[model samples]
Target: MKDWPGPVSTCWNHWIAVPTGDQAGVMEVLSLSSPTPITFAEAQEVIDADAHGNPDDRHHLSRVFVTPEVDSWTLVIGAWCNPCDSERHEDVLRLCKALSARYGGAQAYYYGEQGDGSAWLVAEHGSVVRRYAATGELDDELLTLGDPLPQEQARRLELGLPADGDPQAASSEQIEEWTWAAFHLAPEIAAAYGVSPFTLTREAKVRGTGVLALTPDAASHGI
Candidate 1:
């Protein structure tokens, strides 16, 4: 109801997108529990508290926030989006498969707030079709999987690089040039798929509050 979270409630550090308005089904795939009716402001508080840390609790980071149906997609937000700090790409791929298996399609996106690192993943029927990420550190890329999306290929061609060329093998000059294009593609590609997480309020709203839920790992550990 009350004007769904949005463009300004934005600063989305990480999130997962699935093409369905069914939070219940999305929750099932994510293995979430205890759907507390939370406003966008309240959801932000949970994310903040997790980031702030708790003195007496060791598993404070396991909590995740879910968004109301923005356009036709439900966004599951938390550390899960970054796959536990992106230490393993397999975790990201697995999450994509899990969500896509039931949702028809799924996308995982992480737009690094503290750095230029950004990543986007696409999967259908439990298989990854495209993945791209640049850590913005000493290397040009931290991970790359499957093939480039149509938009990615076109962008690369526009930049004078081969549409299917390996960004990992780019020169320092090509790296600087193309990396700029890659990091910005996260939101652009999201817009193409369905909802750009940042501009949520711009889309039509159906009347439900977002929620704070226990992630699968947290629930398994009884945290």
Candidate 2:
């Protein structure tokens, strides 16, 4: 395997199951639209490697996997980001829109910061039914539409730690401990939340506290 340069910031993993009949069509569409040309086997390999090599940074790999499903298809995309830039945030949104347009029922998860963030988006026929964001500390509105702001369930999960035990809590070590834990646990809960595990992990670190507590729009979207 080749070693990547620079501080690893973002990673993504996605899986989609299509009908055997549509397998060829799905591959063609993904190949044509994606910024990079990746084969099904290659994508799987990347996921496996990232999952094992650095489970913590699995979102940075930006990997996607597709397979054969029943009638239509199922898609899953995962991502991770560094948590400082905004351009990376936009790239993730663009990728989601493109894939959702190609497949009927699609879902996406974005993680990480602005410039070095990672994201994943996938669909079966042509519509996006689910979306998730794990990016730590950055803006939540960048990934979703409308108001109401999303809630960071991943963050909540992390905060679930014993209030006094959490480093961010009054009796804890740091104020951001709860947030960091959230980002770390994001990948583990990605499937349940339909969001990027990596992004959630990063968001935990920078999420604010106190009277100005910010909630992820996803939280209000009904989880």
Candidate 3:
């Protein structure tokens, strides 16, 4: 195990689950088409009206980047809110579902910011399969969420997290280098989500350990 890197900035934590594929694999399936840009006048006005604008700043729906080491794609949306905001949460879900549908119903990952309590969700089509909330609340409504392997479950059991606690605290225990967790996505499920399970697993192994999963068994029950 490597030394714990002090404390992380909880103001913006990331949560993501891509079609069981490497960065390239997931990226290939995802629609990376840039969000329609605002008209030049509107963009300039928004930037100028806000005293905070810098000459280089521009308005956009979200900013995107790839973590090749983790085999996931991340998007930093302009919307910001606390975990308890139902409106924000719903908006996020809608966005995630749309993203998933773009890839022919493949599973999509969403990592939303909520100050020190970020949230992550894995969705197929419009249905949420797995949810990991950092707001000290456990979401068990989605039973279709997949299962973790024995080793994954056992490691989660060892964490012994507290009720009404942040799942990331438990996550810190399992991380080595940059890895969080990786779940074995089933082939059929992957197909439903329009992805290849074989490629997902292959990419995960090749990427080392930046990927991770928080199943209902571990994330909700802390088992």
Report lDDT (CA) for all predictions.
0.72, 0.36, 0.33
Model 1, residue 184: C-alpha shift (Å): 2.7
What's the lDDT of the predicted structure labeled candidate 2? 0.36
* Residue 33 lDDT, candidate 2, scale 0-100: 25
Q: Which rank order by lDDT, best down to worst? A: 1, 2, 3
lDDT (tens digit, per residue) of candidate 2 on 22-107: 54454454442232434334444555465446444324334343332222333333322211135344444444445556543344
RMSD of each: 3.2, 15.0, 14.9
lDDT of 3 at 205: 24
TM-score of 1: 0.83
Stretches > 4 Å off in candidate 3: 1-11, 14-85, 104-115, 137-155, 160-223
Better of 2 and 3 by lDDT: 2
Ten consecutive residues with minimal summed lDDT in candidate 2? 206-215
Candidate 3's residue-wise lDDT over 59-101, tens digit each? 2112232323323332222222111234345554554565566
Whole-model lDDT, model 3: 0.33
- Rank list by TM-score: 1, 2, 3
| TM-score for predicted model 3 compared with the true structure | 0.34
Question: For candidate 1, lDDT tens digit of each residue in 1-223?
Answer: 4645664223436678888889898888767888888877777766656655652463544667888777677887776566325443577678779889888999887776555567888999989888777656543344667888988888888877778967566667875777787767777787888776566664466446688888766765568
Whichever of 2 and 3 has more TM-score, that candidate is 2
Candidate 2 stretches with Cα past 4 Å from truth are 1-21, 28-65, 70-91, 101-104, 110-178, 193-223
